[model samples]
Target: MTLKHTILLFTILIALPMVSQDTSSSVSFWNILKSHCGKAYEGSLALPEEDESFGGKKLVMHVRACSENEIKIPFYVGDDKSRTWILTMNDGILTLKHDHRHEDGTEDDINFYGGTASNAGKKEIQFFPADVRTQQMIPDAATNVWWITLDDKTFTYNLKRLGTERIFKVVMDLTKPIALPEAPWGWVD
Candidate 1:
C-alpha cells in the first residue's frame, strides 16, 4: 500500500474508540439555564414534612430568557401564595431574586453565591440562596434549596417549598431535553 494510505489508516483506527463514546450528555448549569424558549413545565417540589404531602401546595416553574445576557428561571409554590422567584444557576452557584407583584413582572429575592453539592452520588446539588430569609424545610430539618443534576438521558431540578408553619421541601424531575431547555435567553428560539 502507499505510505500515505498506511498512515491514514493507523490514525483512523486510533480514534475509533474515543469517537464512539457519547459523553457530551453531561452539560453545565449555565448552558442549561440559557436555553429556554416559551416552554412551561408542570412539576412539584415534594415537601418532606409528615404533615405536608408531596404535592401539598403547588410547585411549578416558568422559564424565559428574552434578553441577550439572561437566562431566567421563575418559580412558584404552595397555597399561601408566597412570593415568586427568578433564579439563575451557574458557576457552581445559584442566584435568586424575589418577585412579589405576581403580575407586575418585577424581579426580587436577589442573592448570588456558590455552594457545593452535598448529595453528589444521588445526582443532587444544593446551592446557597440568601442570608436571614425563611425558605422551605422538612419536618426532619433538611433545608429546602435549589438542587440541580444531570443523568444519562435527562436533567432535573428540585426547589424546596418555603412556608411558615408547614416548613417543607418539594422535588421536580424533568425527563426531556427539549422540554428542559439549554439557554436562559433561548438563543435558538
Candidate 2:
C-alpha cells in the first residue's frame, strides 16, 4: 500500500523475467540445436581435403533424438548412416561424442570419442577439447578440438588438430531444413 513497498514490488516483478532470460541464454546453444528436433539439414564440407570418403556425397544431419539431458543427431553422408553426434549436459558442462556404428546394428571399435566443453560458452557457440578416451583410442587426436556454432541461419561444426594441420568443418543451412533421412546405422527404429 505504501509508495516505497509498491515501487519495490514493481521492481521485483520486472527483474524476474530478466533473470530467467539470462539463465536460458546461458544454455541457448543447446536449446537452439534441440529446436531442430525431427528436422534435417543439408550441409557441405567447408574445408578442402583429399579424403574422398566425404567427397561428392550429399551430407545430411537429422536432429533425431532429444531429451532434457541429451541430444543425438545422426549425420548422414550419402547412403552411409554410421555417424551420430551425441551432445549431453551434465551439471552445466556440455559434452560431445561421436557414435559410430556398423550396418548390423553393432558398435564400431573406434566409437564414442569426443570431449567436454571447458567453460560456459555463449548462446551461439561451444568448444570441446579431446577427452581421455579419445586420446587412448587415437593418440594423434589427443590434441583435437571441436566446436559448434548455432544461429538463426546456420549451424556449423568445426574441428582442429592442435598439433597438426588437419581440419574439418561443415556448415548447415538452418533456414532450409530438408527431409528426414533414414535411421542411422545401429538404430533399431
Candidate 3:
C-alpha cells in the first residue's frame, strides 16, 4: 500500500475505538427506560398512607411514547387518564415532568411540575429534586425529592416531601407487561 493510504487506514483504526467507548460509557437511565417502550405494567402503592384520590384504584403505567430525546409514560389511576410522566434527556441531563390534562383535552392548572437529575446517575436509578417550577406550583413541595429505580424485575417511582411526613411510592412489575390502555387525555390515538 502507498504511504498516504497506510497513514489514513491507521488513523481510522485509532479513532474507531474512541467512538465506541464514548457510546458505551454514555448509556444512562434514559436508555434503560426507553428499552421498554410500547409496554405497560401494573403497580401498587408502596407507601402506607395513600392519597385518597389514588387509593382503592388500579394503577397502571404505559411507556407509550419514546424517542431519542424523550419518553412519555401515561400513568393511569383507575379510569383516570389525566397524568403522563415525561422524561427528557438533553445535554446529558435528564428531567422529569408531569403532564396533566382534563377529559375535555384542556391542560390542568397544576401541571408540568418536576425536576432534573442533579448528576450523572446510574443506569438503574436517578434522583430529581424539586426545581423552581415545582416550587412555584406547590410551595409545600419545594423540598420534595423524586426518584426512579429500574431493574430487571421492577420499576419504582418514589417521592419524599422533605421536612414533612409525606411520601409516595409505586413499584411496577416490569417482568409481566400488560395490554396497553387507551391514550392519555389530550393525546390522539
Scored by TM-score, the top model is 2
lDDT of 2 by residue, 46-78 (tens): 875555888678989999999999999999988
TM-score of each: 0.43, 0.85, 0.84
Q: For candidate 3, which ten residues in a row score worst on lDDT?
A: 18-27
Q: What is the C-alpha lDDT profile of model 1 across 67-182, one tens digit per residue?
A: 44344555545432234344443333444444443233333343232223322123133344333343222232234455555343333454543443434344444443224433
Q: Which parts of model 3 have CA positions greater than 4 angstroms off?
A: 1-26
Scored by Cα lDDT, where does model 2 land?
Answer: 0.88
Whole-model lDDT per candidate:
0.42, 0.88, 0.88
Model 2 residue runs over 4 Å out of place are 1-26
Pairs in clash, predicted candidate 3: none
Candidate 1, backbone clash total: 22
TM-score-based ranking: 2, 3, 1
Residue 159, model 1: Cα distance from true site in angstroms: 6.7
TM-score of candidate 2 on Cα atoms, chains taken together: 0.85
